[model samples]
Target chain A: MTAWLLPFLVPFIVMNAILGIVTYVTLLERKFAARMQSRIGPYRVGPHGLLQPIADAIKLMMKEDVVPTAADRPIYNLAPIVFVLPCMFIFATIPFAPGLGVADLNIGILFFLAVSAMEIVGLFMAGWGSNNKYAMLSAMRAVNQVISYDLPFIFSALTPVLLAGSLKLSDIAAAQAGLWFIFYPVIGQLAFIAFIVSTVASENRAPFDILEAESELVAGFRVEYSGMKFALIQLGEYAHVIGASFLGALLFLGAWAGPGPEWLGPVWFLITAMLIFLLVTWVRWSFVRIRVDQILALSWKALLPSTLLLLIATAIVVVWRGVPGV
Target chain B: MTIAAPRHVELDYTGSERLTMNMGPQHPSAHGVFRAILQLEGETVVGVDAVIGYLHRCHEKLAETLTYAQYPSIASKTDYVAAMTSEFAYVRAAEMIGKIEVPKRAQYLRVIAAELQRVASHLLWLGTWCLDMGGALGGGATIFLYCIREREMILDLFESLVGARLLYGFYQVGGVRYDLPAGWVDTCRQTVDVIDTRIDEYQRMLEDNPFFQVRTQGVGVISRELAQEVGIAGPLLRGSGVAFDIRRGEPYSSYEDFEFRVPVETSGDCFGRYKVRMAEFRESLTIVRQALDRLPDGPISSRPGLKSVAQTRIPKGEAYARVEGARGEVGCYLIADGSAKPYRMKWRGASFSNLAILPHIIPGHKVADVVAIMGSVDPVFGEVDR
Candidate 1:
């Protein structure tokens, strides 16, 4: 590691930062809820509950790692890892700033799509392997909701790629150097709206959170998990949300392209990511959850068609103009 | 009672893949220790069996062992959320059997206490119901917190009067145990005003919310004929356009002196019931204001000559007293055989009847609608299983 933050150490630094941010995201949610509900949030452990996440991690460690006797032990042991890896892995190809990331893979978006899809498998395993009826029901819902939302999510995300004429995240950001994609006329704005909706749905945030509705299935897929295993699942969930927010930032908001000095490029990226995360938190707290049928109906009926039309229009615009980025 | 199973929706898909999920004996949104076996065809609820009685306290039987004058404390436990109504019913039954004349001031005070109790119970119902709807007013827990904050102001007022916050056995057979204290009426008006403002805030938050409308409107609709056949009362009945309220029709206590309109809706759905309860909050406040304004200056208790509760003699026969409780009708039946203790007692808890209609309503809707419908029904387990 050098003074400039070495290339080899970038993965280590980013991974640690992502994990740290994941911990604080939970704190952010708690504080956000407290402020909305008119109560003082965590304030005992640290100054304004800054160290609450560390305390929570330690408390989870001290707790007994309970495995249900009837559970599929091997899969139960592996589920958290399977779920968490893809979430962290997606950060690898996410260019935080110009040349200030782990990898500049040409197929960064495709890699993100493939890796994120692996999360549902891990989620299903967490549900199925638990050998509980509620868990199974939740897993079935997760499969249905995730798969249905994925189409709209991809179609919406691909609009920027169509405009950029490249799969690389850095190139996409570079394409938006002149102007952020959100300001790219009516077409970009439409895709941005669709992209945000699909993002919430795909990430299984309420009101699309039929999988872990808590009131219905009692923590849903992770109904049987405990101790560090339970902690891992929660970590994976927040990380996945943050990862999705990062992707949203890059695709629509022009990641790291803020009014700042060159040295503060990655800092701008972090700020943008956090702002997007705050937006997600706002939505998660604001709306009631929709029924599973209604969620599917929304994706199929409204989001899918609108995003598809936007995608086609973006493609035509790219071909007609022969855009500079293309 | 074996109610007929509800008709399932005619889905085009074959029912090859089915799932059964047990909701709770300890679930948060169940209200209290309620279990429901939900039969599902992939999130579509095909059938439901509501299992209850986990909070059973043998309340009616326990009343037989206690002295006639001492039963009000026990009655408070039956519907702990709105303890004043249960206490009032028990004392009113005793007063009816003994031919006791309540003081003019005591009757007005009873009206005030009972109306306030209705407001408190309805506030609690609104909060928990929003919690069950999973983020209607705000998040699942946000509206609950806001409502609880408002409820705290009411509880504080009650605590100052009765020296107990939740289960206040503040009524005697003849009159109330305590009178309104100095500056209490003004404080009550102020609290009611704050509550009125908050009720408007909740309406602004939930009534016009598109998400709330989508989840609640036309969902869990109980037809007028079905609601009448099942004999629902209170807001559930009013929501179905039955237009029957015990307070309005029967005019118990000093209700005849206060004029307020009964809120009725024709939708007979969760949203309709929500609107009815919201209207009830305002009406309850109106009744409280009227009772306070017309409050007479007299002795708090008619039987102030009596030294202690145990010394009070009862020359009684069978008597029944029913009140318009928050849920519906809360009736207390006393069968006194010319003695200090009752031979038998029967409590007709409204929650039992309200909860009975669950199996009839849940089959055609999705599983999530169970939470909405159950919340709209507003069953208290303490009342249901007493």
Candidate 2:
């Protein structure tokens, strides 16, 4: 009876924990961005705005759910749930520590990459169902940009898999015990840089954030969404960012491998993930966004070819050194 | 206010459908209450129709009702970003037409106020232009906040000198309204010095940055011939290698006495205009420092203090006084009828003329370039609509 309930209970706990963390991650970003701009962010709420996210959550929940008269109601209502699910689903495969995860699938990194890419469908659905021109234009850009970057993102992620010689994420982490992939010679550094660039592009942050270019598209695909619908869309976006950060930590930084006892493994893993998240956030706030064409050009002309070369080189190095686990 | 009907134009090209998109009057990067109806072939803009007058407040008609004494304060409303320059043009017109002799001391005071106003206004333009290109939540906000921080110091200087920050009624027909308060010069000197160093910081932040360079460079190209033909003034003109500044050419309000270089860039693009403005920031500071050093002791106004609304009357004559405002050449044409109020007053708002060049240059660029071009143009709606 206890074994039967284990799978169900673990997922239920993880979902609730993610929902709570996603809300607070927003506050963390705001504070981080605020310091960069030399201003105090959210100071008026309960004790340095610790309760600000809670207040915001309550407000969003209590607010009216405004559906546009011209909207396709069913798709509009279903889009947020569809979008948030895949983002949260990616976390299930990301092991926080040894023996600590949801499924730990055999093809863990592949599953993570494939499932993470599914958020675009819900993004397009929200944009199409809104019945607004800005939303439609933004959705078009989103499709173009995300598809272009995914190749580079995948090729770069595969570099580490090539280095570790394993499809399983736990095996990849275990192989990093002797030396992290990021600390490996030439191929590792190049792949990590490529990974970060594609991650930023896929996440739709600045310098590549033409889809939601507020100066151009206002709120972009989510322009017509209001109340809790807007909150869910926002939650999904942060969850995706957090999910990517966790994956970056696992693949390159050696997830749960740190200077401490075994019990402190999860704590160190969280720290590494947060560090990766902050690095991406730093890039987001330090550059102006490029045009859609320019963004596409960067992905296809630059990132794609270089990442493919890097992937080929990684495979060569792995074969030359004798594959790690195999 | 009713929006004007969208203009229909014939497209020369066939195949792809043209999407007519309305940007602004309500858009985030509109800069003010400006609307542009853009006809696009995919992401490239093929044609543009600009709409103004949402901020129109009958400024010309109001000038007919108020006397010269009462009108200077209201003149500040025209280009509220550089209110001192706006007031200077109105009062200078009154002083010119009436042949009222302004003291040397008063002339120097006007120069100081105008130059300082130039610095303050450019800081605002720099901040908002970055905000327009960068988006409110991104790197643009970082620059915006830093620029505003420096601008606030200048506003504080104005507050101490004239008892107001923005829309100062500091200028009168003969000269300035208030003499520099005790220790105000020291404060002014300190402020400009601090701003001088901060300007370098801003340059370092954006000058070599590839992201900023791509957004601004070669985005908006206004040829020297087009700039002259369209009647655009100030940095927009100088940026195209015109080098025609009213301050240097006409030399009003003792601007001839100040030693400063009028920056000119022949690149004829958004980057050129940006370089011109950044250089102007330094030149304006130089003039401020010079004016502060040579400030003479005397009564501020040539005319006696205002005892009544109609006490100071202008003789029946016509004169157009133009000053180098923060945006461009701010000119006021006054036809006095030997009465307290003018028979006719016409304002040549710099932004009004500066904005006319948009439809000429905005075509064939992508949608992102529109905001970048508009930001480089830097039209304050108060001046444009008035």
Q: For model 2, how does the per-residue alpha-carbon lDDT over B98-131 read when each residue is reduced to its tens digit? A: 9998888889988888888999899999988888
Question: Per-residue CA lDDT of candidate 1, range A1-326, in tens?
Answer: 37676766888999998999899988988898788878889999999999999999999989998899999999988998898888788888999889878998999998888888779989999999999988888899999999999999999999999999999999998898888898899988998889888988998887778888877777889989989989988888888899888888898788888776887877777778778888877777767778888898899999999899899999999889887564
Global lDDT scores for all candidate models: 0.86, 0.89
Can you write out model 2's per-residue Cα lDDT over A92-160, one digit (the tens) per residue? 898878988898998999999999999999899999999988888889898999999999999999998
List TM-scores for all candidates, in order.
Answer: 0.96, 0.97
- Model 2 chain A weakest lDDT span, ten residues long: A317-326
| Candidate 1: residue A183 Cα off by (Å) | 2.1
lDDT of 1 by residue, B1-386 (tens): 44445666656667676677788888867888889988888778877888988999988889888886788878999889999999988888888888889989999999899989999999899888878877432365677888999999999999999989998988888999888778899999999999999999889888777778888999988888888878788899999988999988998887888999999999989999999999999999998988888888998877855566566666758889999999999898988877778778899898988887888888878877888898999988898888
Instruction: List ranges where model 2 is wrong by over 4 Å.
Output: A324-326, B1-16
Q: For each candidate, report its DockQ versus the true two-chain complex.
A: 0.49, 0.75
DockQ of 2: 0.75
